[model samples]
Target: MIRAYHQPSAVEEALALVARGAVPVAGATGLYTGRSRREAELVDLTGLGLDTIGIHDDRIEIGATVSLQQLAMASSLPGMEGARLRRCCRHVASRPLRNMITAAGNVAHSVYWADLPVALLALDASLEVRRVGASPALVPIADATHGGKHAWDGGLITRIVVPRRAGTLSFGYERFTRTATDYSLSTACVTLRVDGSSARDVRFVVGAVSARPTRLVPVEAALEGSALSDDAISRALAALDRELPIAPNYRAPAEYRRELTQVLARRALETARTWAARENP
Candidate 1:
């Protein structure tokens, strides 16, 4: 049996309640497990009415309680960064799931092969973290946690801020899994800034192959300022092969994951280059 439920109207009050025993819920998307037990104190963040989206200075701030559907269904955004990330949101779980899943909840309890973190990482998104008494601070998407996980301790995620420069990035992702809803067996997010045929900067991230999604910096370094020729692709792939050491999984071996990650990274770069050409031309 659940003990109490509170729906505060203010962010601070909500934080106070959340700092107590209550767990904040935006859409109740992950609240149940087909008749499983429920948390004792449920903090209903929906009533806080934190849902809003807009550009502030150079970052787009997205409320934590905002639904995935709301983000995906928005007609106009100033840039492709939000739109591209929203496209990934549309592919998450299903339409109904998107309608209910909250951005805060999704990242707070990110599981294997989750969508938001992968895309957020690519966009260089930052999190607006608020606590009961402390003023909110922005943490980079890559370092949003205490011990390298997304747990906010006693803090609440008010919104996610994606920097405007994030839009300048071109990206692609690949998921090798059984079904659309099934968590990715392995997933990759590739982003790069290109000028004509030259790579200005690059980042490659792979999910479900480690304790957390990891950035392939060596792969990025290898591709930086390099033209997407056969030799460049080969070198990037080789760099990934040397840098990424995958752990064994029940479904596949470590060697297999390393191979898959390398292949996926190459393919993602190829696709991202194609996307850049279309977007830039």
Candidate 2:
């Protein structure tokens, strides 16, 4: 059934409408494909000026309505971080879909196959959320996306803030799919800093095999202080099964997905190690 459509020009007006049960629409990609046939009022957020990408000295703030294509082409993001994010963004569907999918919408309505959130989790990004009758809050990507808790909770995500790291920082991303635009079978993203011969601040995230992107804490611990040697990588791989418990999916069996995750994760880590050596040396 068709219903009324309202375009709010301000964040506060949008939040108020959302609180009153008006379905918020950004890119409308998910809304169109969604199976919800019930009648609903739509509140469009495109006019709220939430599409700017600001690059600062210590952090990069991405507005919620920014398109994936815009993010991929942003010239301000430099070094390995920029390359990593661009690669992840390019892997999502196709150029047309990327033009229509908003960053906040992808993260907020995250599916198992979502790719950007994996990279964001590895980067330790945070979301600036605005709610009715409350001050805006910054929510960490891990807390906002994982643990079955909705970060917005009827509120709106205004911006996504990613902290910039200084010196010898490297990142790696990997995703598997039958076709270029097909849903991912497995995905992995890694980021770390190299201090001389040892690795520091290691963050390894796995996606497409679970409900949400998950950080492999034990695996990170195994590689954190090591030199990313063969032995260290082996130990980290051994911790993978325990840290990442894959759930069954119709696209693939649980065992298959687990094995695929191991392969993708290994490739991502190896890529990161190579980049670290190249950048640090």
Predicted candidate 2 versus true structure: per-residue lDDT over 27-130, tens digit per residue: 88887554223537777889999999888888888899999999888767876577777888977898999998999988877787778898899998999999
Q: What does candidate 1's lDDT look like per residue over 1-281, in tens digits? A: 67887878888888888787577777776667311136787778887777888766687888888888888887665665766676767777788888888888778765555677777887778888888889788888788765644547577898889877743457778777667776666777787776876776677788878756777788888778887677887888888788875666787788777777777777787888787777767
What's the true lDDT of residue 260 in model 2? 90
Runs of candidate 1 with Cα error greater than 4 angstroms are 32-38, 148-151, 166-168, 245-248, 251-255
The residue pairs found clashing in candidate 1 are none
Question: Which of the numbered candidates is closest to the native, going by highest lDDT?
Answer: 2
Model 2 alpha-carbon miss at residue 41, Å = 0.9
Worst 10 residues of 1 by lDDT: 29-38
